[model samples]
Target: MEIEMIIACDDGEVKKLGYGKTVISCLSYREVWPEKIKIGIVHTDGLDATSILSYLIKVLGNNKKSLVMFDSITIAGFNVISLPGIEKLTGFPSIVIYNYKPSIKNLLNALRPHFIDSKIRELAINQIKSYEKIESKKGILYIVNRGVNKEDAIEIINSYQFYSRIPEPLRLSHIITSQISKIINPYAN
Candidate 1:
């Protein structure tokens, strides 16, 4: 199955970018390994759903019988990406919003004595949690074909938690992304 994911780097901070990279790596790993799936990625600076959705339609080139796997849907992000008449065109796009926050206090307690680190962790957790719960308030609607459903989508996303915070697919994608960057920046001696 073809899996397309729209990823947004909400905050332009380095930490947020790093997390975005990890997410890409995990996506790549999942795409390359296993039965070998087709993965598409769209990255945006601001969470503009309309723009994102427009871009997706442009990239997809007529979305008929296509399966989309969304990592999240922030209103802003959703606004940027929601396409007009997209549901009618695209078939069964299963959305997989990774929901599950471990809590800020818990994270700080586990890390210990690192205020900066703690705060960064908190922000990341909050962003992800918000995407899963708050951002999805509008809810996602897709026409399902065979082998597609909300439960299936959730299961696929849940499978990634077994390994690390970043899913295997995105983790691997991040590695590839970094490698490409390194090709230009190279390494410091």
Candidate 2:
């Protein structure tokens, strides 16, 4: 059977030094382990959707049969990605997987006080509202998908998950970003 290319992306914490850019890491895998890895930096609360799309395009190159996954839609503080934008730009399906069900009220409360950008808040709200809850062997997972049906997304997610509810590519990308964050900002608590 031909293995599907799963490209999982996650972002590190905002760096304490410099302009507080966050490291975005993508791990591409066909099976249990990653075949390729790519990393990029984006300014905290900046236009991360554009940056992420560019980074994904660079990583994807000519590979069109890939499925993109994100740990969450909101990355590097309030920098949120547009799911439909990613799907259209890459010509591939994209899914955002969450271990726990997301709270829209909490998100709204967080976004209302600090950000004046209504566009950002709107995008975030729209993305979170699209999530569908799926019950798996591991546990319940909340996911938002574009260009892929919920059944196929759940199948893909289930096949990749071995030790945890989170898929391998996402798990690895998260670990990689977290470690890179510490290395980049040694003094960050």
Give the 10-residue window scoring lowest on summed lDDT in candidate 1: 7-16
TM-score of each: 0.35, 0.90
- For model 2, the superposed segments whose C-alpha errors exceed 4 Å read 1-3, 186-189
Each candidate: what lDDT?
0.34, 0.78
Which model scores highest in lDDT?
2
- Candidate 2 — number of clashing residue pairs? 0
Q: Write one digit per residue (lDDT tens) for candidate 2, span 50-132.
A: 55755664465456478888988788777788777776677777889999998887887888888789556567567788889
